[model samples]
Target: MTDGDDMKNGSGPAAHSGWRGGHAPRWGTAACVAAVAALLAGLPWAAHGRLPGRLATHWSGGAAPDGSMPLWAAAVFPAGIWLLIALVVSLSRRRARAGARPWRGLVLAPTGTVLVGAQASVVRANLDRTDWHEARQPVWAIVLILALTGAALAVAWRIAVHVASATPAIAPPELDLPEGERLAWFSHAANPWLQLLSAAACLVATGTLVALGVGLASPEALWPVFAVCGVIALASGVFSSVRAKVSEAGLEVAFGPLGWPARRWSPAAIESARAEQRRPSEVGGWGYRLSGHGTTVMLRAGDCLVVRPRGRRSDFAVSVDDAERGAALLNALRRRDRAGIG
Candidate 1:
């Protein structure tokens, strides 16, 4: 296809150049996923003679077990879940642009470690048990599993950072501003669904707090409920709306109605600015997200103002209305700043 067609369809050499991880990374990811799946699925069966007919799969706060799964189910269930997660990661990776940063390892490494650790713990607990009920909760094993999971996540994140840093940033489209002309552009975006969800969460939290205050519910149980609901409300409310502005100074993006939290990039600090179409699913579903596509403040899917900061490999994008004008203004400002510096 011609250059124009390639650019329009996002399938040209420019797009391909963004991909730098090569086949090694993809192959390694696949191998790790397969290995984890195999280990989880085979662990129980490997010790079949020593293990009971069923396994203690769940435990409450105490040493006593509260849930049980048959020998075959225990082995297959976790493996199936691992495979499903792998499938999703694969699909999302496919949807992401070529040469986008790798987020697969960050997700899979910790998940696989947790599942494998849990499967091992289950087998160790039921190794010589006569019945599933006789299996003791491996408290120490749980702690060790948590520690290992943290280590695995840390390793994965470090690897991802190295890979991202090694890849080159895509050159963003630029626009020219006329001499002696000053310009500014503004746009706003909001998701009513997120707003309503936030409101509902806030109401739930408020009701729970009131219940605790009036002695209508247990303080211990209701406090956790209040904490969860409050957190959801705060996050959803903050990301439900956004305002983007580009001017001679640079680009500024403010979040929420109060706009207490905002991000600003001076014209000099911005390498390039462009407008692009993006979706919540592309950035791993809504709000502020860090994924293969980079850091995205996704309020609603559509036009987005995307910018690459000087000396940074990843771009930052925010959903907004009239993003094309905003991006144009930012690019012009950056050019003007560059000329002044020169």
Candidate 2:
């Protein structure tokens, strides 16, 4: 009813501003430091010939002489040093933020570059080695594992920073709709059919990849199978998009590959459209969907509308930001259409 009410309802534009701040958390820094400390402490075991079977073997050559570092030292030393540097950076950032930090987003570049460089170094250094077995176990395996772990940690740290950053205290403005008109908030996400179709496509794609990797399926077969699955997913996504763009005289729908193409429907052939809220479970996950009831398109979030064509049992729904407002707009447009008002 009022601007204050609109803000309270989260319809104001100022509510969703970007986050601010730049720093990692203390716990993450501490964990990294601890891991480094463990690695350094274990160096002594390698020096004293007490290294475990897993560690004793080197990919480039047999273990270095008792007092000498193995060839893999080129890879390990740099990785360790970079990791330590990252730990220090994280710690300093944490302290600087005083427990609240914005997301810098810069840490990703340096960390990612260093890790990629380290891997390249290891691969290049071991390329000429005759013993393939030695190359496989500790050197490649450890490098791979560490690289993946570091990447994951970096991502997690970034997410934490984003979460900790200050957010703008603003909200979206509400839309004004006329009275006496029935409003519908249609959301494709309310439809279960589209979701199931999307999920099935994903599963099939994943299974195909797995089958190909394990040599259970031919590569040639994999491509066609995935291509088909992709098409199916695309179709469902299109159906969902189209369902979200309904109007009085006709509904404009988006579908297919890029989800860019649109479809228009006439109101005379039309049915009824009304707004309704769908529980998260009812939609079968968020986004465009197709259920037994029909296809629903969810573009933003919140409540949606269900539209049933006249004499047609199938209902198409679409989720939007403000269902009541959208319905009002549509109804107004419909009235204009009926009166020959553009």
Candidate 3:
């Protein structure tokens, strides 16, 4: 049987037999419901006034009522507290699993914090009806949100370290290959760093442009900025779509927006290709990336195929659905090239 078939039958280590039959966790469902209830309860607070303390005043537009917190603050405070509580509950549940480690929770905490902080900021921004340029309210709100976000991240990192200490270490599988194929196999591994750098650069550039007042400062200008960001994000998606296809003609790469433009390369130009495992973080969290070492195409996590050019030392890696099959096809093409046969 083909390796793919073996995987489907759960004979392979990567096979997921429980995917279809698995039941949803009751605790997770309960936590989500509770969070939603908390958010709903806070809606009245968010609609009318400001919160307490320095953050409360900063977040509340100066129009906040005397001696009373803003509705927006009331809503956000409860939601934030609920979020923290839910996270703690979820982490406890995860810890109950056999060999479960606290480190996983720690790693994910920052992401949760950022999400909540961003949500709160967005809600506050929407609540205030003032124009961005005239009121200059959003700028201060953004700063406050960022400060809170930073604090949350610091706490998350500390939590992650503690969790990592308690978690059991699992040994990675040994990749066995024929002696002559070792180099070929290694080249196919996907690296995610390239895509992450690209995304980070895009964010930095856009933020810089906004800060420099290059774009319209009015809230209406926000749409155009968002559109530009969308275009950048789409570029990566198009690249990923192209990387997934493998056929007898050669490898087809998607290049343009909506994959309108494509590039085709013959097997003759492909020196070596192989499959490799990739973690979500290592591969730029799933998108197209061009690294200093080589190009990386990824869309989600799992196995990837790395292809090297015939005379070049550097290799390009792409995440694909059937990486092993793609690697086999590349190997066949390489053999054909060596024999001077198509």
Candidate 4:
């Protein structure tokens, strides 16, 4: 499930196999993104003659329309949003060149389908109507669109998996350890921007809580703000920094400054370990990320310690300094354990 490439064909352990799929997947994804954007942009114009001057773009629970936009705006607005999403998703996919990022397809396919469907629905609802208010909510159309979105997601996911499976898996080489010698490696990484973000969120949460307590604002409104800020603060604080260590006991990865929550794997439990260069975009942004690449504790871009656990197909990665040495040390320790050495 790693977004990181398995390995490129070369002589060293650092390089394994080549990507036989070549640039086809990349070009295909770009084409699909462009097609979806075009479809969204074209849907409104296709039925422009029968549609009203203003479209009912938003609706409340009732049948009447609550928000209206000019016909030109309606066509451009959703298309603009779709393009923005496509840009972000495409950049992430491009960053993950080594493996098939199913997460990208999963996100883009459903989102594009929904946007296109919604645009079509809006056109159908406003067809032959004189005023935006005269339009009724497309309840059945919405339901059907949602169902189609699910189908699109399933198809995209299957395609991504098939593409990823085509990439061959590479085995990392075990480092050689000298006789009667103990070895250990340690590395730490942190992002100051994430720390600042967490602090800002905490400050906002505190202010909102105080406002709620002092009756400075409505309890219901302030409560939601407070809750959102609190959650952001907690998550950002926890993943802002990481410490990784490799020893005879295997690899230990600790999260946050306090380091109460950590993950450890025994030498025997690890099948392979390697250091890879990975970016936040490749794994779906900073902090803890779970994508086709498995699970990644991404604090900052650059070197990462990637470990494949025994009996698992996916790899777990953590961003840290000197990850290559750390990985080599871990592999060496695993080999030592396998050799029954003290």
Candidate 5:
């Protein structure tokens, strides 16, 4: 799941892992995002003279128009949102360098554009109208838009999953544990940087919502703000901490409180384990990273244990303290499992 130009490329496990990142696939996905947004944003303009010059963009109570905008603004607002998404992606890419997940942005940008277009579609129908009840959006139109958006999201995720799974696995260096020591390894790690990032994102979302409420932005734009806040809160929960353990049973990775639904590899599942040093670019930046070669739960990125599980094309790398000891223990337990030792 990682790699870079300055990274030391060695033989026999020093550095058998790297990325197959290509710009063609990246740009293909971005184009897909923009194209979908363009098509949806064009709906009102295509309808042309049938619509009015001023549009009722929002409603109050249940049936009266409380907010309005120029027809041109209403027509192109979704496209503007699409461009804004592109700009944000560009900035993040510049900041991240090797940390950027452009593939993810491929999924996010278009899905957001679709949802924005859905809302605008209703407003387009209500143009030149003052009565909210008469201008109420058609239920069928809303339902259809939702259905399409959901389908598009599912397809995009499937594509990303395929790309991730196709990543090549790197073999870990062979090792043996200390004499007289039973096979076992355990360690816990917390990423304060990730917690701080999530907290900052949540605060920004809260600020934006406040601004929208005070009329700094369109009142109807609250849905996207709410969605952003919820996602940040969830990230705050899932990536706050990570725990890795290897024993006779297998290799287990548990994240967050109590680790209720952890990812585990049975004794028969792990192919190899090793202690390794990693760069941020190798794992595609911070907080539970994914790359063309594997997946990594990274914090500051230094010492890590890379695990290759059986029947999978990619490996797993987790940044933690005492990874050398843990990797040795893991290899020992794997040997014990093969020998059926007590």
Candidate 6:
């Protein structure tokens, strides 16, 4: 394919340079992934040779075994994700231009980390036990979650530092809002198309998980579904109905009735609050994204009120209309709070 075609498809010779964002090289990543896959694939046999014909993949505290996988299936499960990650990273590398943001590796870390943890968990679960009734999965779920969180935080911090440091800190124009006066702004937005997409994806995932969990899928397999479901449900709800508020309590953002995954920024905590133009694609797609700029909650790109908190790396950016007004009010509040605190 032509370089243009490769760039359009996001996979070309330039994409494999592996020099973006100070992360490991693409070849190095491929090698590491291969090593992990090999180690995981061999673990079931290396750790314990001559296992039972049918091993326990999952367990339940019940009269009968809930889930089981062929020993080979259990062994290969961890290495299996390597293929997916490699494909994605490969595509990401191909698609990216040589000088573009180094997001490809960061984006793959969470998934790769989770998959590696999963492989280790599965391998450990099936070892040294004749019984298939107890859930032997290692503490992989926590590891996976932590790994994902850590990757996100790392990427956010990198972006924050890069963007914030690069940004010139000229004093914002003053706005008149007294300390006694409660400055508050509220806005609500919903994207029907995104919500519909979420609903469809979640429905399919929920159905798949149900089948796997109940229809003899192992506990090792089912545990991750809970996490996946949580993510999907949260995304589906949050993207559809977004509520943004700026007040004395700082900047507050919530979604839907559950109102989970909410964020509140105190005036004292903010280093800078300003309006900036945001393009959704830069952050690698919308709805809770991370990129060279920072972490963003983008729903229809345009103006965003980006906040850089004190002593933190990632700048919190949310897309909203009339971002300038909100930013001005935020600065006024911050100055007021800074004065009061002093």
- The C-alpha TM-scores of every prediction are 0.48, 0.36, 0.35, 0.47, 0.43, 0.42
Model 6 pairs in collision: 10-94, 10-95, 11-94, 11-95, 12-94, 58-219
TM-score order of candidates, top first? 1, 4, 5, 6, 2, 3
Residues 1-105, candidate 2: write the lDDT tens digits: 001111223332321211111111233334444443333333333232322222222344443412224544533664576566666666766577433343433
- RMSD for all candidates, in order, please: 16.9, 12.0, 14.0, 17.0, 15.1, 17.4
lDDT of 5 by residue, 239-265 (tens): 866667666577778775335347888
lDDT of 6 by residue, 138-166 (tens): 45454655875587558644643432222
Which window of 10 residues has the lowest lDDT sum in candidate 2?
A: 15-24
> Using TM-score as the measure, which candidate wins?
1
Cα lDDT, all candidates = 0.72, 0.45, 0.46, 0.73, 0.59, 0.58
Q: Which stretches of candidate 3 lie over 4 Å from their true place?
A: 1-233, 236-243, 255-258
lDDT of 3 by residue, 1-342 (tens): 001111112222221011111122243235433544443344344444322221232334454322223455545665666567656766685667633433444434444444444445433443444432222235665575577567756765664453333222222222222323321111112123333333444443334333223222354656566566656645543443332334445565544223336555677888788888775577555555666537666654676777887788877776655677667755765665567563
Clashing pairs in 4: 1-292, 1-293, 1-294, 2-293, 3-293, 9-17
**Residue 45 miss distance in model 3 (angstroms):** 22
**Quick one: RMSD of model 2?**
12.0
Model 6: weakest 10-residue lDDT segment is 1-10
Q: After superposition, how far is residue 101 of candidate 1 from its true place, in Å?
A: 43
lDDT of 4 at 71: 80
* Local lDDT at 192 for model 5: 61
TM-score comparison, 3 vs 5, better candidate: 5
What would the per-residue lDDT of candidate 4 be over residues 121-187, giving only the tens digit for each residue?
Answer: 7776787788889998657877988998999888777656644543344445334455665545555
Candidate 2, overall lDDT? 0.45
